[model samples]
Structure formats: C-alpha cells, structure tokens
Target chain A: MGGAAPAAGAPLVGANSSGGSLKALDGRVRILATAAFALATVSFSHFGPLLIALGGAMLVARLVELPILKTLRRIIAMDMFIAFMILMLPFTTLGEPLFFVFGFPASRQGLVEAALIGLKANAIVLMAMALLSSFEPVELARAMGRLGVPERLVHLVLFNIRYIDLLYRELHRLRTAMRARAFRANASWHACVSMGYLIGMMLIRALERSERILQAMKCRGFTGRLYLDGEERIQRLDLVFAAAFAAFVGALTLWEILSVAAL
Target chain B: MHIVDGALTLPVIAVGSAITVAGIGLGLRQMPPEKIPAAGVLSATFFCASLVHMSIGPSSVHLIVNGLCGIVLGWAAFPALFVALLLQAIFFGFGGLTVIGVNTANIAVPAVIVYYLCRRGVVRSSPQVAAIWGAVGGALAIALTTGCVALALSFSGDEFIPAAKLVFFAHIPVMAIEAVLTAAAVYLIRRVKPELLDAFSAASPDLQPVLAAAPEASLRSTQS
Candidate 1:
C-alpha cells in the first residue's frame, strides 16, 4: 500500500506520486497566472462582457497545453452541481416567465441568470484547475509564504496535502475489509450504526500512525521549520512575468470600475 | 459539507480560513505524539466511511463518522479532520483549498460537541446508546454543516442560495444513513474490539457508566 499509485477514481491534483517538477512555470508566469485568476474572479460578479472575455481566456488557456479529456474529467463533478443550480433557477427566481414546465413557470430572466452563474463558476473552476495542475504543492506553499501567509498555515497545508492520499488508501483497505465481512449497511440500521463505530476506531488508529511518523521526523532532525534546496530561488524571469500579469489585471479592473461608475 | 471553490463569499472564506488555522493550532497543541497514529486512522476511517454510499433519492450520500471521532479523540479530532478534509479536497475535490477552513470547522465542531455530549450522558449509556448517539451526532453534524455551507455559498452570488438549498435537501437522506452507520459501528467495536474503547475511556473517566450500562441498555433499546 505504501508505494501504490492513487486509485483510478481519485481526484487528480494531489495524486502525483513523484512530486512533479517544482516551478513548472517561472516566477513571472506564476505571478501572472495568479493575478489573472484573481482579476477574473473579481470581475466575474460585475460585468457580463468581462466574464465572457475571461471565460474565453480560460477556454483557450486550458486548450493549449492540457489534454481535453483530462480537463473534462476534472469538470465532471462540477457539472453536476452546475446543472442542479440551473434547474433550480427557473423555479426559484422572481422574474418574467418564458415557459411552463408541467405546472411550474420557467422564468426567462432566471434562466439567463443561471446560465451566467454557471459560466462564472466554470471559469473559476478552470482557472483553479490550471493553477493546481501547473504548480507543485510545495511551490504553491512557498508562493503563499512569499505573499506573507502565516508560516503555520503554510505548514499545515503542506502536511495535509502530503498525507491525504495515504489516508485514502488506508480507507480503501478498510472498506474492503468491511465488505469481506459481509457487513452490509442495507441489512439494518443497527449494522449502519456499527459502521460509525468502525469509523471511530479507524480515527484512533490514524492518530497512532501519524504520531509515529512525526516522531520519526523529529528523530531525523526535523525542527519546526521546513528547509528546501537552493533551487527554490525566485528567478528574474518570474518577476517579469508577474509584473506583466498584474498590469493586465489592473487594467481590466480599472475598465470595469469606470464602466460601473458611468452607469 | 464541502463548499466548492467560487461558491462562497471571499470574506466568509477568509474569516473561515483564519478560524480554521486557530483550530489547527489548538488541535496541534492539545494532540500528544502517541495520539497522532490514532488521528491518522480516524482520518482513514472518515475517508472510507464516506465511500460507502447508501442510495436514497436521486443521489447517494456517504456517512460522516465525526461523532465517533469526537467520542474518542476529543479536541484532537480537529487536526485529524483537517487531514481528512485536505485529502478529500485533493483526491475527490469535495471541497476546495480556499474553503478548507469553513469545511473543517463545520465537521470538527460537531465532533467536539458529540464528545462533550457523550461524556454528559446526553446520549444513552449502553453500546446501543452509544450507537444511537453516534448516529444522531453524525447526522446532525452533516445537516448543520451543510446548512452553514449553504449560507456561506449564498453570500457569494445570487444563484448560490438556490444551489445551496438543492444540496442541503439532497443531503437529508444521507444524514440519516450516516446516523445508522455510526451506531452500528459503535456496537460492533463494543462486541469484538473492546480495546478501541480504551481511547474514549482515557479521555473521560465517566464513560464507565456507559460501558456498565451497555448490556441492559442494548437489550431494552433493541427490543423497543
């Protein structure tokens, strides 16, 4: 179980076992991407035109390097939630009715509103997918640190990402064990209740395992601080990329603000 | 409730993140070295528990065994929960990194509450009682968390409220399923692996009443 790859159905971002290359993008690129995403989110709520533009930008950006199939897989779960939202919009929103489904009136304004919301949601999700796929977890932690995120928070994020998959594998084994025992929850509520008990027992076991790992780390001279190699240095190109990205976002934001003020 | 990215107001996420950090600090400070393995196992349990989905309405929802964690680990449940959630975020994308704090707090708070409640005998004293309490705790935790998450999501955009309501309603049956699973899990441990109860006993001496009350309680509760 220790050396096994992530399970087939598992989420893709943290499944990279070998800890893929750090700095998949130079400092400038990283900064640019971050700024672009930030701007995209902020503008999303206000201007419809900007939202469309950002959506196109994300669509193009995602299409360039990422496999279409992989991107589609990532979006699959999100699509469910988005669909649900679209379905509810016609029922809940107060606006002009466009059509009737059975006895219920479907609002034209609500449908438009829902479509826009879905678009915004997908854009944000795509941006994040791009960021997570391109950047290593450790590098992201460092970037957060450089941006003045608290050290403790960064450390927590790092440890959490690093060990999460190990926990998942452990969970898979436990589920198999439960199934092997013919402990089906459908049998009775009583059986289901016992499943919770098993969960409790598993939690206790996890604590014990984590404790041993921490002790081993301590023994190996792991102080509170995590030290990386010299390769983590920020290059000049990174700075240039970040500057250009920031300028673009600043300009977009300025345009949105001016447009709003005019209205 | 795992609040997805772009579903919550930035302020709520920001504040939630701060609160989550504080909770982590408290959890770390309180957690002893020997207990870390137990936390990891609990995390694994959480992951596994969620995977065993019980089909209800149009969709299936998995159990969240936070109550059992609360019963055993107490405050340590926070960090343990944090680990489980982080993994869920990365592997399943159940929640996003930005909303980690909110999700962690939503689950951890209930676990802690159940722990305190179990000690007070607010739950029954038998293994059956433990099971029932575990179920109630588990179900209530999920419901409450989902509600909170829905509220947070609503603050982000106009469409958020409707989306949140759909999710909240969808989770109702799942919450019941979780309750049943949590109860059965407790009962099995009492019958087969009694040592698992050792952690709970260590955390609170008062649990003896519950252990002693198990046989008669199980009989009465099961008969009823």
Candidate 2:
C-alpha cells in the first residue's frame, strides 16, 4: 500500500518541483488541460486509443519533467487497488474463451475490458499529476477559487491546507509519546481501544485548537471573509498551451468516435 | 473502494456528481460562517487521522472514520468529506477527477445517514451508552459505504458484479476496526468535552439562548 502518512506531512506550499516549461503555464490553463486530458482518456474503451492515450500521457509527463520512477511507482501503487478487479474480470465477463486457468475460461472481451480500464486509469492519473501536481496545494486551491468554485468551499480548502501540516505534526507528537510507552499496535482488543483513544484525543485537541484559532482571528479583526490572492491574466504562452492541448484532446475525441463507429 | 476513471458508465458518473453537488449545497447551507474555522480544522483532523494505519492480522488498513465524522459534523460532513476526497485525488491519485463524485457520494452519504441515526443517542445518553451508539453508527456507516460502492459498480456493468462482491467482503474487517475506534473516540469525547458533539445543536439559531446560558454559567463560576 502507498504510504499516505508521509504524504500527510509533505510540504503543501513548496517543494520546488515546478521547474519545467509546462509547470510555468498559468494554473487555469494547466487545470483545464488536465481536465481535458482526463475526459478524453476516459471517453474511449478501445485498446488502441487507450494505448495512444497512455503514450500521450507519458509524453506529457516527460514534458513536465516529472520524476519518472516516482511517477511510475505511484501509478503501480494505484493499480494494486484494482488488481483483483482486473484479475476477476477475465473469468467473470461473458465472451469467447481466450484461455483456461484452473478449468475456468478467461474470455477475450473480459481481457480487453480489463486492459482498457487499466490503461485509461493510468493515463488520466499520469497526465493529472504531470499537469497539476507541480503547483503547490495552496496555489491549486487559489486557482480553483478563481475558477468559480464557491468562495466558501475554496476557503475551506485553503484552511485545510493551512492546518494539515500542523495537525499532522501534532499527530506525530502523540504517536511519539505512545512509542515511548513501548506500545505496539496489533490486531488485538487493547491495541484497537488504545488507537481509538488516540483518535479521540486528537479530535478533542483539534476542537480546542480551533477555538483558540477563532479567538486569535477575531483579535485580528476577522469577519468571516478571507481574501484570496488576485487573479493572474492569462499569458500568451498560456493561450498557446491551451490551444495546443485542445487540438490534441479534439483529435483524441475524433479518433474515439471513428473507432467506435468502425466497430 | 475508490473507483478509478473510466470504470463507471457515464450515467452513474452523472448521477453521482449531481447527488454530491446537492449534498454539498445542503451541508454548506447549514454551516454558518463563524463555524468555518471549526469545520476546516476538524476536516483536517479527519484527513490526518485517515492516514493512521492500524494493524489487522498480517496487513494494515487505514480507517476512514466516516462514522465519527457523521456523529460530529452532522449535515456538514458532506463538505468536510468532499474536501478530503478532493485533496486525496489531487495529491495521491488514489481516485480520479471524474469519479470523485461517486467516491464522495459513496463515503459521505453513509456519513450523513449515520449522523441522523446516532446523533440523538450520543447527545442524550451516558458516556457508555453514547459509545455503544457510536460503535453501531461506525459499523453501519462502513457497511453502507461498501454497499454503495457495490451498487455503483453493479450499475456500471454485469462484468463488475464479482468485483463488487469482492470489494464489499474485503471491507468487512474494516467495519469492525472502525467500529471499535469510533466507539472509543466517542467515549472520550463524551467524557472530556461533550459540547464538541453538541456543536450541531449549539449552532442551531433557535438554540442560541440555551448555548449562551451554558457558557455563561462557566463564566460566572470563573468570575466568582
């Protein structure tokens, strides 16, 4: 399983990965391009187009200068979640028998469907990470704010980003304290009850911290209105990138339509 | 249980998206602006808590704790859970952009149901009783979430039936773990800071006087 714990403490505002030309594009443009890529990737079920989409995603990942091994590892970790589904589809779906494993026939259609889902999922995730993961979480949330996400929702996201690291540290401190007591977590009633108490303690502390934060904000003249940064005008480079991405997505869509009709 | 992109059919995705949007709208409506800080911090707490892995036999699993979320946040669990899902998708790619709607609906709808079912019991009962109710709510939320996931998969295609069954069965252990954790958490909250669970009632406009009176009594004692 992927380690979500490390990610929880990852620096949200800065990690200095946005070095490539693609990362330099406007956030809105990148967001739209990522969405377009996802939509186009998912619109097809054919193995041929899905392969093309995966290749295109890889190419984009290259353009974004993403760490290749790290990105591939992340994608493989995601695949583990669906591994059973992919494996089971071959035996379950009805179609011409491709082969037999343990006297059960694996259908050709099922194999195709499984491969298509895997490819489509990987393509979308790679392109999304390539295009948008470079931006700091705060930056992405701000872009979404400008993109007409409800102001309140955007504020909530911003606040979450602001506090996640702090809270994560708090959790770490608590866990460290537990470790000092030689507590070993296992599948036992005592372990579970102790873990439960840990969670409960964290939540109580969180609530009290929020109360203090509210008071601190009120002291600073908070009136429930948080001001997001001013928007950036789309640059010429952003327009060019947007138009190029649109053409690529448009071509993918056309290919999908023709392929489906051909079938 | 996080459905990836292109797995679900278009109609399932659309319906999921529509329901999620409506749920968020309702949740936001009930949340006053002054509560934003509280909601935001609590949401972050859940996000962090979900990252905590618990040992179950040979393998470990991270509990979603949606039952606890529902018990604490009420209708606002919708938006709070949505934010967590969104962050997870964007940062970790555990879920996809398009399927986020279905994922949120699967997790948060059960949370809301749990809230309705257990909130009254937790508020009015003793600590032990509230913890038992919390266990029920926690287990019930996971069961329902797994059911929703299976239903979403089945709706997508007959080919997904086995996968759906597998997903549901795989989560049975999770339900038990979450139940224990949620009960303990609720028990602690009920003992140490009952008002946190009473946030929904305290925030209700009509209940302002009662809420105000509770604090004033403490204020008077402090002054004296």
Candidate 3:
C-alpha cells in the first residue's frame, strides 16, 4: 500500500480502456442509460437490489468490453477512504457477533452492511467507468452539453479538464525537482513548509498565465461559447440500446420494490 | 474526501444539491467576464492540488487545500471545485455523477466559510499574522469538511455515525499537515507576490483586481 503511487489522488483517465468514442450511437446510448442506472443505484440502499445492480453494471461493462480487473482495481483504490470506513463497521457495529478479528467483535449485521456499501460503490463506479470512459473529456463535455446540462456548467467542466493534465504534469516535474534538491518531505514541519512553497509557486504561475491565456483567446475570437462541429442527433441504434439498458435497470428496480412490498 | 454514489440518502442529496446550486450561482456572479480566466486557472490549480503529494513517514497524501482555495478565490471556489469534481467523475471515476452535488457542497461550502474567516489576514501585511490565520483556516476547514461529510452520511440514517467518526479521525493528521502547508503558503505569497493575495479580493475595500498581472495591484497591496 505504501508503494502505491500517489497518482491515484488525482487519478487521470489512462486507467480506463478509452474504449470507444461517444460519437458512436452506442456510446451516447450507453452514457444516457448508464447515467440513469447510476442514479437509481444511488437511491437504492438494500443489499439485494445492490447485488443485482452490481451484476447488471458488470454486464454493461462486459458489453463495452472494458478491461474489467484494471477498472475494478482503480475503483477500489480511488475509494480506499470510504472502503476503510466501511470495513470498520464490522468491528464497531453492534449485532449478533459472528466472530472476532484482532479481538474485536465482528457482527453479522455489520458484515452485511459492509457488503452493501462495497457492492453499491463498485456497481456505480463500474457503470461509470464502462460508459463514461469511452469518450475523451472534451467529447464527454459536448455530449453533456447536448444532453441539456447548463452550458455554463458544461464549459466549466470542459475548461477544467482542458487544464488538469497539463497542470498535473507540471506538478509532477516540480516535485521531481524538489526531490532532486534533497526535499524529502517526510513527516515534519519543514516538509509541509517545503510542499507549501511548491504549491504557492505553482499557483502564482497559473494565476499570471491566466491573464495571457485570456488575451490569446480574445485574439482568436473565442467568444464565451465553445463551438464544436457535429452535435449529432440520437440515432435509432442509440434508442434501442438505451431502451434495453432502461429495461434492465427498470426490471431490477421493480423487483426490489415488489420484494420490499412483499416483506 | 469524495463520497461515492449510493452513499447518501434522498433528503441529503436534495438539500446538498440545492445549497450547491446557490453557491455556484454566487460564484458565477463573483467571477466577472475578465475574471473567468483567472477563476478557470485557479479552478485548475485546486483541481490539480490533489495530485501534489507530500511524503509522510512511508507514504503520502495529496493536499485538498479547499481552505487555501477559499482564501484566494472566495465564492469562486464553488464553480472551481464543482468543475474538478465533475471532471474527476467523468475522466477518472473518482466520485459518481449522482453525488456531484453533495460532494461539491461538502468541499466548497467549507471553503467559502474559510474565505470569510481567514482571507483578510491572508492578505494582511504581517506575515506571521497571515500565517497564523492561514493555519487556523486550513485546519478548521478540514474539520468543518469532515463535519459536513458526516452530516451528509448521517442524513441517510443513524447507522453512518460510526463511519462519520472514522472519517473525522482519519483526517486529523491531514488537518495538521494542511495547517502548516497553508500557513507556509500564505506567508510565502505575502512575501513573494502580495498582489496575488488580493487579486480576487472583491470584499476588500483597499484593493481591486489586477487581472492583467500588472505591477500596479502589487504596488497598492504592498502600500496599503
């Protein structure tokens, strides 16, 4: 765990399959349908619904032919904080004690709750990785814009994505330089101060550059709008795929509801 | 500090989203046409801040610096952080799209609070005073953020109280590291480029935006 690269903190998109372009009919459909399913998964809390959703989400991932294990690892790694908290529940939560781990009581209810969080988080993340990873960030932003999200919000997202990678690379280089200069930053006040100075320099540079970037944009006649060609309509294939995805999610949701009613 | 989907209840989601929308609205209003570029860049800075890991013991953790963002960007931290969260969801699957509202509010709201609580001293003349205030703001921001995260977690039910406690405890070290980092950063900026401390100081009567990176704002921030 200590050896794991700190890159997961920002987590760029290279872990994803870059599966396909969302310009394709299926890509758009996948985005639309998976988004709905993701929301549905969020609203759901039960273990059974979540387990079913996890299977369904995995199936969607398979449909896209995504690299499954890699994406799963990335998901778990990114969510380690939440995972850590959930893992603690088994020891901390009071219920019928099933066993002991390190002399702490592990309970049945706690184990079930932990499983629910794990499955729920994995299902949502898998669906996201499979469907959303198909498009580049710019393409995804455009698709989101076309999907009726506010243009301001869309542009904000696009602009940030536009700069995140370049800035991250700069940060990596700067850190390397610091390390070269014998900046170890190892659990000390001096370490924090060194890192803080580094961040301050980075922020100051970015602040100065913003003015020039704006002027360059103005010179290029970049009005407040980001205009891109080929905002395509939803094709028949997209509709069919969207319908199928909807049906799968709907069926599961209905089953969960009915089962709850029965209970 | 990012929460995944299915981790929050409906009322929590609803209230969190509503407050987030309002915050962004305020942020947009604060960001003038000329300032959007600066906001964009600052947004990117905050976005990338997470990737900058300060080594500790055998491992490392990235800086959240929402407190620093708020100190510098004020309400603009709203759209700044919102964009970052959205891109992370899209590009990296770090957090889910459904939870964007809750996540943004959780991070940015505390940032805005710190802005009110600490931005003045950050731009103050005395570096020690500025650093002290920065440290307070930075450490307090994480505590507040953890509290907000816990609040959102508990909104689903009482079952999440333990998880909330776990989150708060886990972040104590981060909070201290952040305090020192923020204090150091505030002091350095105050020493190196004073204008930047007031570049977005809309509330400060003594200073105005030097959007062009001209030396005049620096002169005034220094003199005043």
Candidate 1: residue A261 lDDT (0-100)? 85
Which digits, one per residue and each the tens of the lDDT, describe model 1 over residues A100-159? 989788887778766655555566555554544455565666666666554444555565
Segments of candidate 2 deviating more than 4 angstroms? A1-16, A229-231, B201-224
Residue-wise C-alpha lDDT for candidate 1, range B1-224, written one tens digit per residue: 56555546678877777877776665654433333334444545555555555544454455666766666566666766776775455434345555678888878877777777663342336666766666676677677777777767776666567678877887777677766766666666655555555543354423344522343443244235
Models sorted by lDDT, best on top: 2, 3, 1
Best by lDDT: 2
Residue B83, candidate 2: alpha-carbon lDDT: 90
Evaluated at residue A242, the lDDT of candidate 1 is 58
- Write candidate 3's Cα lDDT for A83-193 as tens digits: 776777787677999999888889999888777767777788878877777556667777777776655566677667767666777777887787789987675988888
What are the clashing pairs of model 3? none
Predicted complex 3: DockQ: 0.44
Give the candidate number with the greatest TM-score: 2
- A1-263: candidate 2 lDDT, tens digit per residue: 31344455356323225637776677788778888788778888677778878888888778778777767777887899778888899899999999999999999999988888889888888888877776777778878878888766877888888887788778877787887898876657777789889988888888898888877876775655557665677888888888888888888888889988988
**Every model's TM-score:** 0.75, 0.92, 0.88
> How accurately is candidate 2 docked according to DockQ?
0.50
Single out the weakest 10-residue window by summed lDDT for candidate 3 chain B.
Answer: B204-213
Question: Tens-digit lDDT track for model 3 on B94-129?
Answer: 876778899999999999999998887777549989
